[model samples]
Target: MHLRKLIPFIGLVGLCCACVFAQQPAATGLVDAARGRVAIPDPTKPPPLTNSVNDDQRRPRNYDMQPPTIPHRVDGYQIDKNFNKCMDCHARDKSAFTLAVPVSPTHYIDRDGKALQQISTRRYFCLQCHFAQEPVQPIVGNGFENVDALAKKAADASQAGKK
Candidate 1:
């Protein structure tokens, strides 16, 4: 009975110690991509908000299974438990008339893998998986290669090795 009463206190102390230890200086001199050189305890001034790219042109996906990015600005769009403004144009039944790409069929699948007539509650929040492109400079450089590019490079290397 006493151990059970003390368990919560012990867990709290352990969590505090873990947080302190986690903030110790990185031995590898790695800088946080988001915070840059600022220490963990220091407050960072956020960059100014940039305008979203609103050309309505679909950009290429960076990787496999990447959710499509919103091609238009979604400012002032209402997304709440009561309503989803995205469904106005992107719903399957309305996309043809609106000429907007329909929400993928996968969005209709429930956690149990059963198909629902409407968008699954789990996937109703479009912004959770999709983001509108912004024309802002990246804070950190990336050297990401898509699977298609990697596969083509491997094929070319094999052909060169045979020659």
Candidate 2:
């Protein structure tokens, strides 16, 4: 009976020790030794910048380039069992001759090479993979230039970089 009563106290002390050990400073001077403390630097290094891409950045090339970014705002768009905004334009049946941009041919193929005429229930939500965005103004400054025309320029750049 007495041992059972003491079990909670022992557990509490062990937990307190664990907390203290976790707070103790490391040998690396990056951490402060006293007050069981460490210091952290403010305003960490900025993320590396990628060159801005326009529609022209999409091109036919030997190797795959990065996927093009979504070009419009996607916030508050429904992308679930209840609704999907993307199909109004890109559905295989609707896009052709309907003033809708046709979906990529890749979208039609299933893993088994069968043409999945209907959007898979798993992929019913278009926003899961696609998003909309607008060009952001330069936050600070950069000298980067857009290739502006992907179909012709990508091959040259890739070839030049290789050589």
Candidate 3:
């Protein structure tokens, strides 16, 4: 009697194990296509660095709130905790001598709204907002238009209505 009950339980466990180990067909299409390509490049060799030409042309800001882009290359400009190379020319006192635009007055304001003699810790890293403007082909397409363009279109429509 004991063996008869034990045999059925053993058979059920064996059936479950067989189901778990049963081979399923490999996933097709996209999965197989992605698997054919190399996921990671060789780590031993460094990737080629592309040098972008510095145009030095000031691009008009799309909006008033946008930060001005850097007009020149900032290659090898040290901006560690101890120093910032941008301040050499853009500092309030240094701007007059170097002919570089002085950093904004807002850069001196602290988080608590207190003004400091030096650049605030919150705004010390210039690269956080300012990036070197480089002319390059867009990696993806966009249909973005600025507010000024929309306003001009509205104005033109209103003028046409009067005429």
Candidate 4:
């Protein structure tokens, strides 16, 4: 008797499920459009390969702790285990003659804080920290404000509040 009642209940559930599934629309809008299209590259024309031009004009640092960007082109400048062309111009003794800013005195200190007569190997690679500035559009939008700008805004607000 119980089994006969359970059979009708199960049948009702299956019918409801079938109705729900039947009412669902076909996945045919964006998916169907994408499936019908073939993304083919232009075989006759090649994509342009352009090199970024370095900005020789010195740009001011946004913050005090920021590393200065290279103000000149550094392409083909050798910086390897055997040779560091940067030292030829930026070394302490050579800076006066070359008119290039010398590497920071801190670069002469080792990891243990021992001062060496020569630039510590830890800081030998100039390009590792200093990169040439290139004029290029930012890939993404940013509303970032510098520390000085933020500070000035706060100060201005405080002064207005006092008045």
What's each prediction's clash count? 0, 2, 0, 0
Q: Which is superior by lDDT, 1 or 2?
A: 1
Candidate 4 Cα deviation (angstroms), residue 100: 0.8
| lDDT of model 1 at position 28 | 51
For residues 19-80, could you state the per-residue lDDT of candidate 3 as single tens digits?
65543223322222323333334233324445545776777888877998877889999998
| lDDT top scorer | 1
Taking all chains together, the TM-score of candidate 3 against the true structure is 0.68
In model 1, the Cα lDDT at residue 9 comes to 96
Off by over 4 Å in 2: 1-66, 96-98, 121-123, 137-163
lDDT per residue for candidate 4 within 38-85, as digits (tens), equals: 333323343353454565566788887677888888889998888889
The TM-score ranking, best first, is 1, 3, 4, 2
Which residue ranges in model 1 land beyond 4 Å of their true spot?
1-29
Runs with alpha carbons beyond 4 Å of true place in candidate 4: 1-55
RMSD of 4: 11.8
Candidate 1: give the clashing pairs.
none
Tens-digit lDDT string for candidate 2 (1-163): 6999999999999999877775554633334322224244443454554443435343333334434455544455666666666776668788875655566666666777777877765456565564444455545555644555564588889899999
